[model samples]
Target chain A: MSLNVGVIGAGAMGTAISQCIAPNTNKLLLYARRKEICDDINEGHINCEYHPSVKLHKNIMAVNDLCDLKDVDVIFLCIPSSVMRQTMVQLNDIVSDKCIFVSTAKGIENKTNKRMSEVIEEETGRSAVVLSGPNIASEMMKNLPSATTIASIKKKDLEIVKNVLSTPKLKVNTNHDVIGTEFCGIIKNILAISQGICKGMGINDNAKFAVFTKSYNETKCIIEKLGGNRSTVDDYCGFGDIITASTLNVSRNHTLGIWYGQGVYLDEQTGVLFEGKNTTIVLKEICDKLNIECLTVNFVYDVIILKKSPKKAFYALWEKL
Target chain B: MSLNVGVIGAGAMGTAISQCIAPNTNKLLLYARRKEICDDINEGHINCEYHPSVKLHKNIMAVNDLCDLKDVDVIFLCIPSSVMRQTMVQLNDIVSDKCIFVSTAKGIENKTNKRMSEVIEEETGRSAVVLSGPNIASEMMKNLPSATTIASIKKKDLEIVKNVLSTPKLKVNTNHDVIGTEFCGIIKNILAISQGICKGMGINDNAKFAVFTKSYNETKCIIEKLGGNRSTVDDYCGFGDIITASTLNVSRNHTLGIWYGQGVYLDEQTGVLFEGKNTTIVLKEICDKLNIECLTVNFVYDVIILKKSPKKAFYALWEKL
Candidate 1:
């Protein structure tokens, strides 16, 4: 019953997911873009760069060439969203026609406002399954108890991915709402930044959580408007991930927002990219076109993008409440 | 334009609420059962026991007798849910017939299984306005930014309470879903204990938040079954308060769950009176009678009430997920 699985990228998430599903797969081919990382994972039995203390599973074989994935039953696209489309285009020419693609990236195209699944669909000429939840890669690497939601339009695809992802330590829930699953990952970044901004401005706990409740409902509204089930937002991908990213200090986007809230602007020269910054702009545009007014999106946009005074933007949001 | 308002109970919540609305009232009467606290507030302009640093508003006058509330336009019942019925019965004879009652208690009568509002109705023969949210007393005492949801069957009552409670620092959202609002306060205790048990058991973030998401949706389901709006769970009363009590360590129920999870059973002698413990027992009975199979409630009952191993109960809950 085991399938041949391949995971693209050797970053934290890519390495961790490979570790999670290696036991369920006959052969887990983890595609590392860097030659040294591939060699280290294959020979040393460890992802030395990201997860040095933990050893990779015996079933996981790190590969540097894309051709090694031609026989995989499924390829998980763990690359950054910025490179997802091009990676899919390259991967489409190599993988078999029946090979299913799973998107773990949580970003939309800058200009097209297309989700990662849409990008994979455009490039692969097939529907893509999405995997998302309150997963922290480091925790997954340690094999701590975790759970996630996998979604696809095809029930068969969902069944396969669910089987591959679920283990005693890692639980997976399957659903048919692909858009909701993927957008949950995207919208959660905005929620994180909004909460970070509130924390940065030293907003009280009651006010912060009040705004969080508003943002949570707005997420359901936006997802429903995009033809996804509103109740999907109550799932692990939506509520679970949103709380994890927003409340915990682990997310880079949340850290970025804290800096902005403190009026310390982090420029691009820092070399750290925040998908949430781009997400705020893109979501603001989406809400504007749809004539939907979302306070969370606007608050993050004003403080982070427009560089408005954090106190002023916060008071404006509180006034609306 | 200003109405006479009275707040019963000189506890932290009562004094803080009085401070919040004193600006909007002509004469704010805060009823303290203890004669010394009443004298302290009236003579010193401070509830020295509950809030020593924050000065009570001059418009607020502490009263030692129930007769002092006779002419008040609105009365807020801030006493323990255990004393709520009897207090209402006493005030029923003193307060004017046209006076509005607001219940800030977040408990259900143990034997009767009636909510605070229902208890008020039984004792006073009036529809009591229900006020609940992620309101922390200390923060509200300092007039820090806060928001709350008030629900009443009557539109006029909601409007009047909203006007009295609304301040630049305190935002108020009014709704007609009194049942939903009342149940939200009652249900959040279970969520707090569940999350606290998870934290005490050292459950991973992914697993904890995944169970949290499930419990949240279950809250909506149970509320709906109890003749409340499902969407009302998304308001300040449900999502806001649930997150506040569950995530923050300020809640006694959360700390109690932590102790129980760590295998430290505290007897009634150490009792600071955790409302969550009683809430867990009552909710289990209610769910059993209603034939609602809720995993969160069951998990909490197993660990806290039945004295089951925290790890065993959590694993059982995770297996279902």
Candidate 2:
């Protein structure tokens, strides 16, 4: 059975998903907002914006209109969370009811405080799977091996997702906790920023270890309170991703954190989009509303909101210690 | 009230501990096996072998004889695990029971499979405290801020250990799970080697996450079976240290794992000691006797004992996955 695959969005994650799916499937239709990107992908067999080095698989075809994917068996949504709801609503009017969605975007809707998958289910009335880990797009394009988890509420959908996403270079495991998995993907970014702050502040590995310990404990508590399995963050999406994002020099959030720690304004940084900045604000608000004692989040909030230097933020933390 | 501080070794960690304690204590006694090291410290006020840049505090007095520390209130044992028992025996004959011991050495005796803290308690008949985390001696000596946990069986002893160890740049948290804390410090080296193997084998962050997840789960199970709090490893000494050691390029165990992963013999490498190699064999034997199923340990055993390549080791792991 050759399932029809459609990737919505021409972002790095979408391109990577298309590349991974191209080898296993008979047809891969990639939907891009810009007509030129779709044309380039179709005619040149390359995603010039995201993955331009390797030639895309011949099975892939690009479509400019969402209606072109009316028969897609599975659609991977990689659009940013800000426009996810509007896109999903528009997608619901065109795509068939049988289409399954797998979201790679990691974020919570500020307006509703709902996860991307939850928003997907609400807007399109379709259950969606989430795929996330310490997936750095640049490394994946270099053909380096990596692992991620595909989580779905349904076991059958999870198995199908595993079959579709897993490759020799990209190992995909099935996770039952969609909420926990999604939360892990989002919360790690904030923690990674804190790690960068630690590094920029000239903190040693021993101190970083303490900060991570406290952060992970707080993350577990939030996961459990949200009616999700606490162990999800302890695995790939949480512990692994957080460590990679925080410690790896090239990570955007980490870089931003370093700049922030060094007293550089977030806007002054040129070539990076720090997801942790937004996540920190949203998460801090949530924590305050729920009375969750998340010291790491508060410290990050002080840097991002209160405009405190890394030294001052650390001094505040020392008082609690 | 002023306390008498005695550091049992003049190695990097011993020197760092002495440096941290020098500003707080009234009398700091550093005991070294070589009389020349003691003479150099007392005369020149510098431990060139360990920390060359930092001048020793004038209050520090170095002594070569063990009997000189008999009246000391606290002694930090920082000698290597191979010589721990012999050193403890010598100290026990001289030091009074009131002189509490704080061990920073992280290792398990091959003959007894007992942790360093256990050995200290058994030999000296004193309940000792353990100081462990990602305490990189070189970084600490440079006054780079760091944090670690101080664990003891008793709350009173834990408080005293915290007071002795906690400095402005070095934050110390108290833990009651001494068994779990000690095991975390010892086991992380083996796990770090596994991480290095992954990096050497060209494995991506995804696969590494899976490996760590399984390793941590197995560790928690083992800790629980050993009658220790399972959550102890989830803190600084376990998760924090393991991640830092594995990811950091400077870690010796990670470097050793990389060499082994690349098919270099253990003995072929000079100026490096891989504690994980010995830990793998000893821990495997321990797990076997206890009927604990630890896949990561078994994989490491296959690599070291069976002389399997990373490719073969991962292939075996894939079957289980």
Candidate 3:
């Protein structure tokens, strides 16, 4: 069936996904927080703060209200984690039943370890899917090759996602294992931060790589142990994405490592968000509750958020490994 | 036990390993092919091809004859895969009786899917330990941090290998999964070439990441299916080393990917003998013999070696996935 797509957040991710799918030709709607924001978007197709280089589709328009998107067949929640709950609260009644719920956000609700898609499904009272991979929004806007996994419980829902998101430049792979995909996306940043901190340690390249491999395997174990698919770790939504996220400057957490290398503090101009910051706490809780080694995430929490020296946290975690 | 480390070959890999262990106050022997080569190394500490940056150790004495190493406690076979069999045959009778062997070469003997360690063992009539990891000769000269794996079917042999190799900058981890680590070092270059091809496709970041994940999983499958330890995929010898090999310019294979993207051929200047060029053929044969899916490696094979256009090979592989 032909689909009408609605992007619920006119941020960097929203722009990237919008460009990935149909633009002027297909029925499309974009939702932003304010009319001024919509005006800025309409006047200039680019999101100035995020993707300053790429332009947007002419047919894509920003709306101040969710009811404006009622006719759309799929809704992509691209808002940040902090605003997702409020955004969902406002759209719950307005969103149509025909629309497939999907989230492009990469955070776990600290209050609950619920993934973004979980929160969407819970808020909208409908099954939801999550899109996760190693993505740089700026690069996606330039129509550079990228891939991501769309995860949902139903194969039909997955097909709908594939239909809506696929483009010549953006390849979307689907999996029935939503938990594994979402879990990999959220937890990887924490690992990236831990990786950053390890580079901060006096440890040489060998120790850094050993640490990277060990922490990644440890992350995979936690996800797989929780009844998620082992094969998920083999996909872009898993290992490759995690590597890009941890190693490249494209990631906020990876940037944390760069800053740590340069001895700079995490600040606003970093234009990077520790997407896993909220989830680090939740992950530690999950580890504590399950008694599985959440060694990497815990190391990140202690070394980064709590201001613990890598020497102390590294040894603490090193002993466990 | 006090160890006498003997290194065969005076080129980069051989010289680096010799220098690494020479500072330990051990009697270090360097086997050179020509008399002049031995004299040059004895007179000056420079290894022309591999590491020109580091100074050689005073304890290292270059000898042209193999019998001079007969009293050595450990012998490292640092010859290329092409000539290893011939050298192994010569060393079979000359090596010390209790000397454990370690190999610095990376490759599967092209015509026979035999690993470097396997070739050395058969040639020397003794299975030397395998030193597998992403150890850069140039980086090793700088004494940069890097890690490697030392493995043997025998526990005592592995212990001997580890103690000799483990240093502050280059820590050696022990494992029984010698085969797995070997495949990772060889196959990752092939995958790095694939990574470059995807980059050349100019696809979005997510799509690129997705292809990487698929390639990684597929590589893991080929290794595990061939009777390797699966856990090494997340260890320094395997995944970590692969990361270093694939992601950076330090890898010949990675450079090959860049050349493939730029429409150039990967050759000797790539830093190391790019195993992907030949290993893909061996990998194809191994997979065929073992009945495993080596989609990523085989894809690179068809494109790079078989002279098929990359576009056609990519689409063919994409459709199957």
> For this target, which candidate reaches the highest DockQ against the unseen true structure?
1
lDDT of 1 at A224: 90
The best candidate by lDDT is 1
Q: What does each candidate score in C-alpha RMSD?
A: 1.2, 2.7, 3.7
Higher-DockQ candidate among 2 and 3? 2
The DockQ for candidate 3, computed on C-alphas, is 0.51
Q: How many residue pairs clash in each candidate?
A: 0, 3, 14
Q: Write the number of the candidate with greater TM-score, choosing between 1 and 2.
A: 1
Report the candidate with higher lDDT, 1 versus 3: 1
lDDT of each: 0.92, 0.82, 0.75
Instruction: Show the lowest summed lDDT stretch of 10 residues, model 2 chain B.
Output: B265-274
Candidate 2 lDDT: 0.82
Q: TM-score of the B chain in model 2?
A: 0.95
Worst ten in a row by lDDT for model 1 chain A: A266-275
- How high is the TM-score of chain B in model 1? 0.99
For each candidate in turn, the TM-score is 0.98, 0.92, 0.87
Give the lowest summed-lDDT range of ten residues in model 1 chain B: B263-272
Model 2: residues >4 Å from true position, as ranges?
A139-143, A268-273, B266-273, B304-306, B318-321
